[model samples]
Target chain A: MQKDSQKTKLRPGQLSRPKNLNLFTIRLPINALVSILHRATGCVLFLILPVILLLLQFSLSSAQHYETVIAILHSPFIKLMLLGLAWAFFHHFFAGIRHLAMDVHWMTTLMKARYTSKVVLVLGVLATLVLAVKIWM
Target chain B: MLIELLTKRYPGMRAWLTQRLSALVMAVYSVFAVARFLIVQPNSYEAWVDFFQPLWWRIATLLFWISLCIHAWLGIRDVFKDYVPNPSVRDVLDKLLVVSLWVYLVWATWLLLG
Candidate 1:
C-alpha cells in the first residue's frame, strides 16, 4: 500500500503534464526538417500514383492520345505544377538516400548529419532547376 | 543474424530492410530512367514508344513498380499510424490503402505486360 502510494506520487498521470500544441512555435532542426519533408514528399508521391498510371496508360493507348498528353504536359500551369511535383520527387529521393546512408551508420554524427542534410536539400533544388531549364529552354 | 532479424519474429526489422532495399532499387531505376531519357531524347510519340520497346526495359519497369507498391504500402501505413489516433478510422484508412495499392499493382501490370 505504501509503495503504491509512492508510485502514484512519483509518477503523475500523463494528463497532468503541460502541453504546447502550437506548431509554429516549434523550431525544427535541419535534420528534422529534412526528415519531415521526406515523409511529406513520400505521401505526395504515393497519392500521385494513380494519376501517373492513368497518364502512362493514356500515353500508350494511341498516337492521338499520346500527343494529347504531351500537349497537356506542355501547358504553362501544368508545367509549373509538374515542377513542384518534380521538386517533391527530388527531395524525397535525395533525403531517402541520406536516410539509407544513415541506416548503414554513415554520417550518424550530429555535425556530419547536418552537413549531409544541407547537401540533400541543395541537390534536390539543383536537380529540379536543371529539369526546369530543360523543360523551358 | 541478418537472416534472423528478417524473419517473422521481427516484423519491424523486415519492414526497415525492405524499405531500404526498395529505395535502392528505385534509385537505380530513376537514375537509369533519366539517363535513358536524355540519351534517347524521345520527343515524338514513335520515339517514346520505342523507348519502352525493349523486353528487358519492361521487366525492369515491372520490378520497379512492384518495389514501389511495397515501399508505398509500408511508408503510408506508418504515416497513418503516426497521425491517426483513432483506431477505427486508421483501420479503415489502412484497408483503403492496401486495396488501392493492389489495384494500382494490377493496373500497372496490365499496362506494362498486357
Candidate 2:
C-alpha cells in the first residue's frame, strides 16, 4: 500500500535524451524533420527574394550590368548557394504537393505517407542533380 | 451530409482546391524549368537572348511564372490566415499580398524576357 502510494506521488520517469543530432536521431521523426525543413525552406526562399530581385534588376539595367550579374553568378560561392537554393526549392515544392495531397484525402495512409515523403526527397535530389549537372557542365 | 458539414467547418473549398492544383502545376513546371536552364545553359548574353527569343520557350516561361505566382499566393494566404486572427485585417493583408506578388511576378518576367 505504501509502495503504491509512492508510485502515484512520484509520477513517471524523465524521458531520455535524443540519441543523435544527425538525421537518424531517435527523437526526431521523419515527418517532424520534413515539417521543420518545410518551414526552413520557406524562410530561405523569403530571404532569397531580394537576391533574386537584385539579379533581375541588374540583368535588366543594361548589357554591362547583365554581364556583371552573370559574372557574379559564376562565382564558386554563388554556385554553392544556388545549389543549396535549388535543393531547398525543390524540397519545399514537392513537400507542399504532398501536403496538399494529404489535405485532399490522397496518400493519407501511414505507409503511403511515409512512402510519399521518401519519394519526394528522392525526386528533389534527382531534380537538383539534373540542374547541377546542367549548370556546371 | 458529413462532407457538407466538414466543408462548412473549413470554408473556402474553392480556395483550397485551386491552391493544391496550382501547386501541382508549379511542381511539374519547376522541374522542366530547372532542366531547361541547366541543359541549354546560356553562358553568354547572346545565348541567353537566343534562348529567350524562342516563342514557345517564352510561352513556357510565362506559364511557369503564372504557376509560381499562384502557388506563392496560395501558400502565403495560408500563412496569413493562420497568423492573423481578425477577419477584416486578414482580408486586407491577403489582398495586399496577392497584388504585390502579381506585381513582382510581372516585373520579374518582363526583366527576364524583355
Q: DockQ of all candidates, in order?
A: 0.82, 0.31
Candidate 2 error regions (>4 Å): A1-28, A60-62, A100-106, A125-137, B1-11, B85-96, B112-114
Native-to-model Cα distance after best TM-score fit, residue A117 in candidate 2, in Å = 1.9
What level of docking quality does candidate 1 show? Answer: high
Clashing pairs in 1: none
Candidate-wise lDDT, in order: 0.94, 0.76
lDDT of 2: 0.76
Give chain A TM for each model in order. Answer: 0.87, 0.81
At residue A2, what lDDT does model 2 achieve? 55
Tens-digit lDDT track for model 2 on B1-114? 646744656667656666667767767776787678779987777776676677787777677667767767776777777789999999999898777777878776776566
Q: Candidate 2 - CAPRI tier?
A: acceptable
Q: What is the lDDT of residue A86 in candidate 1?
A: 100
| Model 1: per-residue Cα lDDT over A16-122, one tens digit each | 33569999999999999999999999999999999999999999888999999999999999999999999999999999999988888999999999999999999
